[model samples]
Target: MESDSAYRSRVRSWLDDNLSGRFAHLRGLGGPGREHEAFGERIEWERHLAAAGFTCVGWPPEHGGQGATLQQQVIFYEEYARAGAPATVSHMGQELLGPTLIEFGTPAQQKRFLPGIKNVTELWCQGYSEPGAGSDLASVATTAVRDGDEWVITGQKVWTSLAHVADWCFVIARTEPGSKRHRGLSYLLVPMKQPGVEVRPIKQLTGTSEFNEVFFDGARTAADCIVGEPGEGWRVAMGTLAFERGIATLGKQIGFRRELDAVIGEAKATGAYDDAAVRSAIARACVRLDVMRAYALRSLGNADAGTAAASKLLWSNWHRDLGDLAMMVRGASGLTVGEGYDLDDWQRLYLFTRADTIYGGSNEVQRNVIAERVLQLPREVRQ
Candidate 1:
């Protein structure tokens, strides 16, 4: 058996070697608020990664994956981030849905779906958030009624990242009539290219349209596409959300590290480092980043009752503050953009991380989760 150290070294070598040549240009290209950069090139780069069997390193061996250990998985994410590899286009497929299916989907579903995810043959988008139910996922109103051999779906999902480019969407919909909240829900893998589906791009503050509003009007998939039992979609969806904050985010922390390094350097270059206040802020950011990484590594497999909310709260608040600091360091200059509404990287970072505390799990929701689930104070009674 290869030691974790040996595997880590091997991963580093592969990244150093492969991220050269044609792929060299892709490093540091795509990420948050800048998903529109080098779209085709990044897709190809991810395909190259898939060919090398490095895509789903954490999946079990039975599932055509490397079956990497928890430590190795963490190492892979960290090294991959350190290499400045662009954010993966297949992340939703490879990270969230794939693991969810492996745990809850039928053998036939896994056999049919997992390969496309690994090989990047078919891209995926998450259809969880709707205009009516973003953080309150249990209140989803999407409907998937049985129609002979297929489930006809109808609903609108908002803030769907990359739905405009996805081949499939694993959706949570009301399966049984008269059921509300978490009941009567089912997880269905609906095809995105059907006649009933409409994807409209939503332009964000970053001057990029990485998110979309997807309308599903009678969109259909095989009735067998349901993951887990009907009305048990809530459980499956929650499980998938658990994986959403997994090792992949560890790599994201590395990106955060680079951004901090850049901000520190920017502070120095702009002579903001000379200010005692700026120096104090930069030092504080450095300390918080180290704390974030340590907490992330320790909580990779964290199954503590309400600690998930704590983890989300910790990082999101820190990132939002980092963005604020980036803008603060730039002073009035950060408020302006280049020609054609084009934002500089820091400008985009500042603008985009505005939602760092809102998306995934909103800061409000995280606090509620901690208050209700962990502290047992009292769940906010949703009207």
Candidate 2:
């Protein structure tokens, strides 16, 4: 086996060669249609990553990974960001469900699903948020009833990112109706191509159907489809959410820093850097960007040590700060869409950042977690 440094260098060299030329056509600011095409191309690019053994670098070699160390995984991501590779399409799977399955899945489940997910052959969407649930995932109203060899599922999941193109969903449903809210939940792997599953696009402020409303009416999965124990869905879901909020956030922060660098370069070229106020603003943005990067690195370290909570208080705050600063720097141009002389990418990012506080648990909820769990503060009283 190659040494870790040798492995990382080899992977870095390969990515530098393979991904550098493919993203030139995708460089400009984009509207919804362009975003769609970019995502499709990204999916193809993820397949190439899988073929090159970079997609699941931390997984064992038997599962189509390179069996790399956690440090190697970090190095790969850093190098990929440095190389300006197009974003991968298997994030929801690779970051969320794949880790969950590896931890909670049976050997048979692992054998059946891991390879497909690793290669992007089966795209997966998260089905935790619903019209009523939102940040309170424990309140999800989706129902799944066991029927001998099958489970009959019915519910509506909103804010399902990429549900239209997803091949499967890791759905959270109420399996025990009258039990405690979190206690009765069960996680099911529901196939989207089944007869009773419907995916309706939800157009965003950017006029893109990047997310969707997924409805499951009498949809069925095998009884064995329950990940982990039947009533243990809450724990499994929390595990997945931890990955969502931690390692995935690290990946995003690294990528966003590149954009922040570009914004700084643009400000300098336009002479905005000379204005005292603009200079101060840019400095503040850079400071917050650095903080975000540091927090992400800390979270990755915690994740590798297996101690990350379902969410972190500092992570959300820094993320919001970074987004707000980028938009503020872009000024009026931040409100426009599509390719323009101005920072239209900043505008798109600004719009999307509104959801950051809400998704992965609202910032309010995260603050509460920190106060009660981390600082040992008194819990707030509410009716």
Candidate 3:
């Protein structure tokens, strides 16, 4: 095995060499509020990453990945983020859906989907959130029914990131009639470009449309598209959610570190660092970031819904607060957009992080998960 330092050096060298010329513009684009920065260019940049064997570093080698060790994966992500690489366009497909497919999908399903993901030939979007179901995921109302060789689906999904650009969507649908809550759900892989599917961009406070409202009216997927058993989709869906909190979070922290450094610089330049309270808030952010890293690293093993919930809760609050601090350090200027809707990075961060606590798992839902699962407390009695 290569030494971790050497591996990180190799990744740095690769990025330094490749992220120039035509791709220089993509260096810091397509992250959380900035997904609209460069549309076509980032897709090409993703394919460029895939061509250089930099895409799926953690999956087993048999499934078109490097089969990297956990430490190696962590190192790669750290180096990638440290290099200021753009937020990945293929993150959902490579990190979440691809791994879930390998774990629960049939050999044929893996063969059909994994290669496309590995090469960035086919992009993916998640279909787990719906109009009536967000964090209460078990309350999925999207319905799919048998149609000989295919499952015809009809439902409305909101807050679906990149649904307009994705080629396929892995969906959680009600497969059995009247089976309430967590039961009767199946995880199905549905195509997104078909006639029955309609995608409308939902503008966010950042004045971007990274999230979409996707409507499936008689949308279809093969009968064999189900990841696990027909009615066991909740299990499969939850597994994919766990993957969301996996090794990539280590890299995410590296981005957080960069943002922190920038904020510290702002404090120093604006004389906010002279204020005792601002200094203390900066110190607190440093400590919380370290704690987040420790939690994420320890979370690599034994990832269940409870563990995933904890990780999400920890990072969500920290990041959202960091955004709040960004505004505080910048004083009054951070509130205004530059010339119409063009926002500076701090302005974008401030607006975007407002939804951070609400998107992945709402603060209320995260609290509920932690209360019921990790703490083993009494469940909330619903009226």
Candidate 4:
């Protein structure tokens, strides 16, 4: 195996060379709340990355990846961020669902799904959250029943990121009648373009519609689409969640540093840097970012539930706080937008990070995981 430095060099060289010409315009485009920017163009750029073997760097080579070591994967993300490459459109497929499928999926299932994900031919959205079951995933109320060779699905999923453009969704639905909570649930792969599936965009504060509410009315998929046994969906879904909080987040830390530097630059220009409070906040943000990086590095490949939960709490809160700091740097002007409600990048960051602590897994949920699972405290009472 090549050294980590050699891998980093290779990744940096590729991104620097490729993110030019027609794709040059996409530098720094698309992210958390900005997924709507250059929607079609970003997908094309991601395909370029996939062709270059940049996407899914950590997966084994036989699965259409570089089989990159965890360190090399971290290096890839760091270089990708440093090059100002646009955020990937295939994260749900490449990061979360692909890993889950590799772990729990049958050979036939892997063959059917992995190639599309690797080539960016089929984008995927997660159908785990609903209006009632955002973080408490065990309470997913969607239902899928076997009919002939297919499972008919009927339910609604809310806050599904990028469902508007996704070709598929990995859904958690109850497959057994009279079953409650985590029991009798199954992880099924469902197609999004079917007549039975409807995607309605949900506009966010950033005025982008990346999140969607999807309705499944008799949507159908082959019975072989299930990842694990029918009653074991909860376990499979948990594996996806663990992968969701994996090392890919290191790239986000670099983005945070960029945002912080921009805020500091704004502070200097606006004379806000002279204020002791603003200066102190800048210092704290810098220190917290370093700490988060270290913590993320330490927790890499450690899938312990408590560790993942704590990692989420650490980065989400720090990012949400960074948003607050950006607002502080902007002072009064931050409150207003242009005539067409055009927001500057700082303004968008402030508005978007508001949901950081709430989405994925909320702060409360992370605390519960730490408290009950790690500390062995009594589990929170659920009605």
How should the candidates be ordered by TM-score, best one leading?
A: 4, 1, 3, 2
Query: How do the residues 1-383 of candidate 4 rate in per-residue lDDT, one tens digit apiece?
Result: 89999988988988889999999999999989998889899999999988888888898888888999888889998899999999899999999999998899998999999999999999999998999999898888999999999999999999999998999999999999889998999999999988899999998888888999999999999999999999899999989999999988998899888888989999999999999999999999899899999999988889989999998998898988888998998899999899888999889988899999988988999999999999999999988
Q: Estimate each model's TM-score.
A: 0.98, 0.89, 0.97, 0.99
Encode model 2's per-residue lDDT on 1-383: one tens digit a residue.
67878977897789767755665554332322234757777777778878877787767777667776766777777777666666666778887888888889898888888999998899999999999898778788999998999999999999888888899999999999887668889989988998999999986755567788999999999999989888899999988877676545555556667767776787777766777887787687678767766756665646421234333545555555656766666667666565542335656566666666676677677666667777778987744
lDDT of 3 at 330: 86
Maximum-lDDT candidate: 4
- Alpha-carbon local distance difference test for all models: 0.89, 0.75, 0.90, 0.92
TM-score of 4: 0.99
Over 1-383, each residue of candidate 1 has an lDDT whose tens digit, in order, gives 89999999999999999999999999998877778889889999999988998999999978979999989998999999999988889889999999999999899999999999999899999999999899888889999999999999999999888999899998989999999899999999999988999999998988788889999988889989999998999999888888887777778888888999999999899988898988898889989888888888878788553667777887888888888889878988988888898788788888898878888878888888788887789668778
The lDDT, on a scale of 0 to 1, for candidate 2 is 0.75
Residue-level lDDT for 186 in candidate 4: 96
Candidate 4: segments with Cα more than 4 A from true spot: none
The weakest ten consecutive residues by lDDT in model 1 span 303-312
